[model samples]
Target: MTMLDRRALLTKAAWAALAAPAALGGCASPAPLRHDPFRLGVASGDPLPDGMVLWTRLMGAPAAGADAAPLPGAEPIAVRWEVAEDAHFRRIAQRGVATALPELAHSVHVEVRGLAPGRWYHYRFLLGDAVSPPARTRTAPAPHELPGHLRLVHASCQRWEHGHYAAWRHVCAERPDLVVFLGDYVYEYPSPPDATGLARTHTLPLARTLADWRERYALHKSDPLLQAAHACAPWLVTWDDHEVQNDYAGTHGRGEPGDFLQLRAAAWQAFYEHMPLRAGTLAASGFGQLQLYRRQPWGRLAHLHVLDTRQWRDLQACRAPDGPARAVRPSACPELLQPGRTLLGTPQERWLREGLALDANSQPVRFSVLAQQTLFAPRHYPSGVQSTDSWDGYPAARTRLLQDIADIAPRNTVLLGGDIHQNYVCNVETQVAGRTRVVASEFCGTSVTSRSGTTQDKVDAIRRLNPHVLLARCEERGYCVSDVTPQRWTATLRAVRDPLDATSDAWDLARFVVEDGRPGPQPA
Candidate 1:
């Protein structure tokens, strides 16, 4: 029989078997093979009213070395995918075939389009007799339509060796319409010699080469709970430092070693292969250049401005030439106030300035959402010391962005972020025209499983100094869920009982709310 005949036959069989309601991670598991190529599972990201990108990678094994990718000179594999209007997949909304290339380690990115807006659909992939786990994805509400509500879960910093992914387990249960993941998705470090309190360990050394980065992503994605979160909803993802190296500013790394740009290219390639990023232009930077900063809308209610802080950022202030950033006293570091020092670079800053306002064919956006990595609010540490790693390092840059957001978007703005590994709900303020005012609400969320070095004493000191901070809680691992409506926006802080246990239960740490016109969160 021809290849098309085999695929046609398999399609019917796969759909027949996947018609069962329980499909996420519970499909075709009993079948045996040399190794599960769909080990990284499937994901959908950056949803629009029409569609989103569906991603999956074929891997022989996640271990470092030969099994990390397909054997030498392997031909691309033809994979079939289907999207159904119902959970049982009785009515097919969309179906197509995509080639999983060997050059990209047999990964597939299907940008399924032309779907109805503001609705959920079930999707699955079929390879030969093997059927991938069925997952769900939702399209954004149509631009002209004013949706009554929007629910999104913000998460980040799930370092592999630190703890369990129980936080993601709870995220799956939340049934959000979207998940905004802000960086540190994988740690670039090697497995520590001391297992000590580590709940997991990488089988490989530090990620440098393309193979190394690919294996690292596979290891992180190997966790079923993490896969479940991806399956639960479409995600809006942006990277932070650890995806390449710790505290890396643009192409430069800390006083460490090796060619940083090459390292960045490999890491970028692996990240693109693993993530459900929209397929488009390849930048001149080594691998395909991924344009991370863009605006996404949730109907007429909100406009999400997702920023890429690392790729285009100037090397953090007061660092040695070509070195990474460090916390320095403003008195010692004269370069800290350089007006040219930028976090989003100049081009991105211009794009953000333009993207913050109304788009070409979109309606008046009620909520202007800033989704980026790290805290947007000012942090004042005692003794005149400030971390050059956050927004505090670039006060002028921060003021520029904040002033534009305030001048254009005003009280309708909301900032969502991660990377601090702590929960901080603050009334973000900025100086514009000689007057400082709270113009946007900021919810800098905690890490998924990564541990925070911040202590309660430090939290207390920050609260004392920054009166705009409403809630500050560190030394815990969790995620945040926000519900946005025409009247108010509410956020529930979900924390896990034991991050070390796979089956650990998660509870609400706290809740905060912001009225439609108010630019700050209050205890609900």
Candidate 2:
């Protein structure tokens, strides 16, 4: 069939399934195929009020080489997907047939619409007679209505070789309404020989080409626990440095200097191909240009402003671009405070400001949620040093953003950040002249499996330096869950006892809350 005809068929099949649920019977009990075509598992993400994106890749094997290929030939593969009102898929809501083109790695991203809002859905994929595992997903509340409550998990930095994905298992157990993943979904580097013992290694070496990046993503997606989290809740994700390269800003890497645009193009393409992001975000040719920064609303309860920090940020300041730039004092790195330096870039910064304005004017947006990578709260090390990678590096830009936030002053502003691999609950204050006005609350979640950079003593030291910091933890690894109500928002930092142990159980490290009118976090 022609491409246009195939798309039409896919849409027709999906709507037909939705219109006549009874006609799409036996979805729960499809005859088994000769071979499993979904070894990488299935996922759903970016749920809207009426639709969500369902994802799956047809794979023949698990390895990176030819023996592990999913499809048999270069021809397009026909795949069928179904969404149901029940886990058993007895009440089908939507079903579609998609052509998994060989050029796009035999992956299918079906944007299924025409469903009820604030409801649960079970989805599965079919390849010929082969049936993929059924996964659960949910649609967001309708935009015009006000949601009474929302539960969401904020997670980031799941390095493959660090340890087991026990944190993901815990996240899936929570089964929150949604998941906001703030970057570092995959590391571009391979395991180093001198590194701490690895729980697993990358399927291939460092990802410099499209093939390498695809292999790495496939390897990570192969994890059953990770897949479970993706299947459980529709995720809104934005990548940090590791999604392409370590400490990369725009087209530049730390100090390994070259025109990295080509390599970046490959990484971008691979990321788009694997992610459950919508088709409109896909690039037409060359490197993919995805507008990763956008606002996702949970009715009027919250406006989750997901940011892309690494994509447009200016390079690190006060040192060589190739080497590790140690934390420096203000006097040593005055260039870091340059007015022109920006983390979100000018366009995105404007987009965010305008987006917040539009959201508040249109609805009763209770919370202006900043869900992005890296900390917005300033960290002051006891040695009179500050990180050059976080908001601290772009002091002027941070000031501008904070000042604007203070000026517009949303009812309840909270920043959800990750990338430091440490948990920090701080009060975001804007200082004008000599007066400090507490404008927002910041809850920075820890990593999933990555190691923390500081000890308890170090955490204490940093907290001492930055009095706005209410709580800090640096030794453990896990994610955070937040419960949002119209009256108050509470967050619980859940840390796994040991990331190396697959059976490790997580416990609540601490809990913080932001009251309806109060902008800063208070101990709960």
Candidate 3:
């Protein structure tokens, strides 16, 4: 061949090599990417009456970082998704193509629309010939149409190293209508030195960069039980501090401020990329600056106001740079009593207040639900001390919110939360002119696998100081399942006796109920 012909042939060979992976079903891994592109499984979230967000990530070849992001210059993978009326997908409802962009970690989030109200739909994604396992998702009930009953499981604090995710497997078996996650989805640090007798170990250390965060998320997602739970139902998720750094507040680190914006931005990006969130959550800069606080209704029966407390809160008062968690009395930490110290940032606070007002006055919903992170009810420790990281530290803000609840006086109000690693049932109360009155009922679920930070002695002391707290269990590792009706709401605590055992059985440890128009829970 002539010299020019030889050069052209060499160019063609290079292009063919680049296209080989795409030809062989887009398996980009060293052994050729497998047909199982659904290793992370499929998930749906942000349910509305008309639609929900369907998600899947196209894992081409296993990249250098163990599926943490993709190869630096890997070609964009073409992904197609479909929603069907049948599990077999014989009756196609919606289908579309979404390019899995490399910059966004090859993840595809399709906000599938035009579905029937309060109905289940099956969805799946296709990358060339490889198809993801089908997932089932449901839309919310129609407005003003009462759903006689709503079943949901709200959980948080699933530390990978502490134990097995048997609780998640159980939750999938229970098959609630929706799963609300409050926070601590993944711990930022790997298995720390102080984490004694852990059932498992994290492969990575503290997560700092985007790649690190992605790998951490992948590690958590690698659990089959967790993946089964995500596939089983639609999830409404909000993050707590561990999604970034532990105890991080709005633009503030746990202790003194430092140059953490870059870290925060990276963490936020990783969170959004992994979650089955809507398209609107994506920021122009690829960081998750999305306002996550909003309301969803189960027809006219319940209005759930999901909240984000960590991304928009003032720093904890009297927190030392490096030491144990700080709890202080009124005299020592005067900053704790400041009226301007807010857990929900100003904009979110206003939004929530206005939403509550609208629900109570104009909409007239039966139950107004506050779904958020941490304890909303006051927890007073012995000797007038309180945890600075929880609502106890932001008394003024909590009081303001309670006042809002009292002003409108919804027929029934319930608060759902997590993050304390213990189950608690309390009567949310507020004092006016030396007279204390219960305003709502709150149920905070325990961690899925992590150990409880509250000691039994401390829990007993706290119970004594806060009389409205009806039940507190600091030793269990499990989740809360709620059955809601127009007449009452019942929450049952399902605990895993041994979180280290993958095959261990979970039992209902306790159950509490709040009657309509009542502000406290009683043993049911």
Candidate 4:
């Protein structure tokens, strides 16, 4: 049977099973037997050449215990998994069975090894009679090998209530090697707030408990478009303000009292449960913190530096009517414009500086790509309006970051950002060695489903003020596809016709490419 057929059948079966229990007067439970398995879908993430992580959850009712817990006397069940070279399970390369217990919500995380590099493989989870759909994954390219070509798709800000995820369907069809989810994966605020913004078409009844978060994830995952995209390639994810709370800084919430430690802990736990991340166990401290910042090398073509900007950033000060002149006039908001104020914190900043130094001297690593969230270019509201939400609010910090990039002077450093619901391509210019130097290009992707009215026009106005910007597109909803090679790196902005319509099609709105020695983007 085809995948669509299988999915349809599963949907019908699930609905029937749910309704059967009520009609039978609770005499016959429609719950799957203990041995009848295949619960949650299969997923894989954090791909490495030597190995990758596999994940799955056990099946159970919403409340199998008196306390309404998922599983009461749930014993550890053994799950068997296999990775094969073919989809038919003919040549099995690696196999293993893991025990799932209640402590981890009956979820299994298997870090398998002994696999070939730069090759595709199929994997699945098995119990007694139930089997999950086959998932396809690939390993990263070797360290020094110069890959002829590399393709990647990036997207962000998927608000479930706003519209359908048709863009994800289009991206899945492209079959990218890696999928980069920038931020705002899930919103935490409840519905029906006092204030309504342009992006606030559909609001969720606030998320309070872990179950609320899980339900939200399930709703999104139920969308075939997103699931298909996840199944197509391994995903690298990061969270924005909405994932926890809007404008939350460090361990504090927006305007809540008491210690925010409890909320932070809960948010972290829920995040781990849904993502395909391997739980690393360390001595004394139990499991180590989930390290989000890291560098991935795609052969000799590019070095992708994934950054976490929200976790450690200082809160931005409100902008004045006349811009920085009036806002930082008395230095009352010095912390907001402080040179040492950081988005990646002190330690991460140091680490990134070191990584850039190494990549600048390395012969094999040609392009230095920074995958981050938010617009790096200086964006102002209009002639008189101003907001402290973007990088423009922190001029000193932005200058420092630009100076560092200029100092390194890598062959080609490109920044890919999301959040702000618009598209932009700008040149990062700064003063170096008593002379003006421009080094690197940046591409800011528009939202996948969020609303962005008049944003594109504002970006256009900013481009005119800042000549370094090559292009900007605001009035569109879509994702970006990038092609990386040794000689040049090209990025295409694909825009969807409309988000409200289910049958909307996608087309390339703009295209830009950067050569080996060039520092800025040019029309392809």
- Provide the TM-score for each candidate, comma-separated: 0.90, 0.91, 0.90, 0.84
Candidate 4 positional error at 343, Å: 0.8
Q: Of the candidates numbered 1 and 4, which has the greater TM-score value?
A: 1
Q: Which whole-number lDDT from 0 to 100 does residue 251 have in model 1?
A: 62
Steric collisions counted per model: 1, 5, 3, 3
Question: For residues 1-524, could you state the per-residue lDDT of candidate 2 as single tens digits?
Answer: 34565455345333322323232332222245656788878878888898888878777644435324545567655677888999888998887776565556777777888999989899998776778899888999998777888999999999988889999889988979999899999998878866567776654788898789888888888788898888888888889888887777776774344547667867887787788876656433324356788778788889888898887898888757566545778888889989999999999999988877765577658898999998899898878887888899889889889987877777888999999999999999988778998999999999999877668998898898889999888888999999999899999999999888888999999999899988898889
lDDT of 3 at 204: 92
Report lDDT (CA) for all predictions.
0.81, 0.81, 0.81, 0.69
lDDT of 4 by residue, 1-524 (tens): 34565345334322221211112221222233543234346677777776677766665544332111243454556666888899999999877666554444556667766688788888887665567778888887877777888888889988765666889889878888888889887877564444433323333457766666655555455566776777788777777767766666554464344435445545655666667665541112221134667787776777888887766766656433222322233245554655666677788888888888878887737898888988887654446444455576666767877877887777789999988888888877777777766688888999998766565566677777767778777788899999988898899999899777656799999999988888888899
Best by TM-score: 2
Q: What C-alpha lDDT, on a 0 to 100 scale, does residue 47 get in candidate 1?
A: 86
**CA displacement after TM-score superposition, residue 466 of candidate 4 (Å):** 2.5
Clashing residue pairs in candidate 1 (N, C-alpha, C atoms within 3 angstroms)? 283-289
The residue-by-residue lDDT of candidate 3 on 79-128, one tens digit each, is 66888899999998877766565656777677766789999898898766
List per-candidate RMSD values in Å: 6.9, 4.7, 7.6, 9.5
The residue ranges of model 2 lying beyond 4 angstroms of the native Cα positions read 1-33, 62-72, 194-196, 254-259, 284-288, 324-326
* lDDT per residue (tens digit) for residues 197-295 in model 1: 999776688888898998788778878999999999999888999989888887678434457777887898788778887655234332525688888
Off by over 4 Å in 4: 1-40, 59-74, 191-204, 257-259, 281-289, 318-332, 384-386, 453-455
lDDT of 2 at 77: 56
